[model samples]
Target: MKSPQALGLALIAALALSACQDKAAAPEDIRPVRYIVAGGQAEIGGDSYAGEIRARNETQLAFRVAGKVAAKLVNNGERVKKGQPLARLDPSDYQLDLAAKQAQLAAAESDLAQQQLNLKRYRELLAKQFISQAQVDAQQNGVNAAQAKLKQARAALDASRNQTGYATLAADADGVVSQVQAEPGLVVAAGQPVAKLSQDGPREVAIQVPENALDAVRRAGGFRVTLWKGGAPLEGKLRELSADADPATRTYPARIALSGDSRSLQLGMTAAVALPARASGELKLPLTAILDLQGKHYVWTVDDKTLRVSRKPVEVASIDSDGASIASGARAGDKIVTAGVHLLREGQRVKLLGQ
Candidate 1:
């Protein structure tokens, strides 16, 4: 028979051993994580910019002469041909000025004819010895002065005629009137925009690019434009890029010319331009996936078979609003943990959120 003190000691040892076994058999903590598949069908490191479909050539139409607008001949979105009347100014003042010039020209012609007759008479008198050579010379000088005055008057008359014709504003090319800025009663200065015209021709996509992406945009091979209303992506070539940033938006305005069959594109249609990635064949991951320890960068990659998370050292080429571009360490079709990266450890068992 065992002693009471020995029985107590045995009981205590058994309880301790049971506790140890329970702890050893317990399951490990499995962290649930969100992950992304790298290098899928979507191109990594590329960018998309919202833009608008616009005519390759848009012009602000204005009158050559300042006057009170008498009539606006074209409405918004109206198509006009070259030399077609677009708007008209009040012709009352111009007509009166033309009449005055015409009257002055008539007076000058009458004076010139009278002076020529006098010169002829003076020469005849000199030939007959009735008048001195000095008198004939004076009459000839008067005729020459009259002729010069007549030419001046005629030139003034021609200018007046042109001014009268200018009272009616005409379209310089075939286009659609996108906007009208003047009313019939408004008095506008010469060269002040009265309407906006979109010339008929090839179309372009107008996009605003940030300063940081200017180099990428310049180096891109080409662009693909997709309309907001849905259509096949159209190929585009960079046509114009503003050297100076826009004061209001602080973005560089860029125009991408569309190639092949842009006739269906209308002005002001919203679109998006896809800019190619700066570097090709590189994996891209979310910024959250990047784990920064000290000065080095790392990502949490998942094992396909074991579903274990491992810390991966990666080389980041660049980081932007889109995400981070992985230059090395990660490749296409690799699964990466995008969330809860800071709490994860190497070889930690993980449960994919959607799996």
Candidate 2:
């Protein structure tokens, strides 16, 4: 036999060798991970803008001629028909001016008749050799001048008549007077807005969109408009979009035309317009599921059969508070690792935490 110290050393070596063998034979680590289904009904958060209901054909009513407003025929919110008088200006000055033009026209007509008679007499004298050819020609020229003056006077009289009629501002179309800017005794210039008329036609919603969301708004398939006074949501289509941003607000003004049962919608009603997210059919996932490496975006997807995690490159469309909208590289029913994405490796076996 060996000495006691040697025996102890040999035993220790054998114990260490057995421990190494046991460690080598141990089972592989199976990491538990939190995961989620790639494709579901989850949608990225969309944008909403506060808007106002308005007529699609709003117009500013104004007088064609400058004058003092004598009377305002219609008040605010009054329904008016085409050709209905909205306001009246003082007719005293216009009437007096019309009278002056009429007098001038009468004088011109009388002068023209006298000139024609003188020209006929001169022609007769020339035929009888009682007057020279030049004299007859001069009389003809005088008649021509009188005829021109008569035509000018007639045009002036017509213009004056039109001015007098313009003293009464009338509605151009059937509409409701939304605003009355000119009151009785207020002097207004030509083309100044006296009232605002909302024509009876299709109703629309006007909304302001920020510059950052303009692209999404433009690409949206449709919109939903909800009224503030509690009514069913109305379907809407984008009708118009401003190319330039508003200088003061730095927002783009857009108009959405409402469809189906807009009769109850009135002008100036507050509303909200919902703009859907741009990526319609793309899959969405939590932001934590995505991994950024080497200036590229990727995600850890788990295999269904093997339960193995693998890095997948994905095309990211947009990221918001809701989640990341994936454009490609992932499909419906694929398991995606939501938590511990960075710790996972390619082809590594994993156990779903919840499952």
The most accurate candidate by TM-score is: 1
Regions more than 4 Å wrong, model 1: 41-45, 277-280
Pairs of residues at least 3 apart in sequence or in different chains that clash in candidate 2:
none
- What would the TM-scores of all predictions be? 0.93, 0.73
Sliding window of 10 residues with minimal summed lDDT for model 2: 38-47
**lDDT digits (tens) for residues 213-272 of candidate 1:** 898899888998889899788999899999999999999999999999896788899998
lDDT by residue (1-355, candidate 2, tens digit) is 8999999999999999999999999997789998887665444346789999999998998999999999989899999999999999999999999999999999999999999999999988988999899999999999999999999999999999999999999988998999998899999999999899999988999999998888878888899888999878888999999999999999999999999867567789999998765354668888899999988999988888888888989999988765888888988778888888888878999989852
Error of 2 at 113 (Å): 0.7
Candidate 2 segments whose C-alpha is farther than 4 A from its true place: 1-42, 277-281, 285-323, 326-355
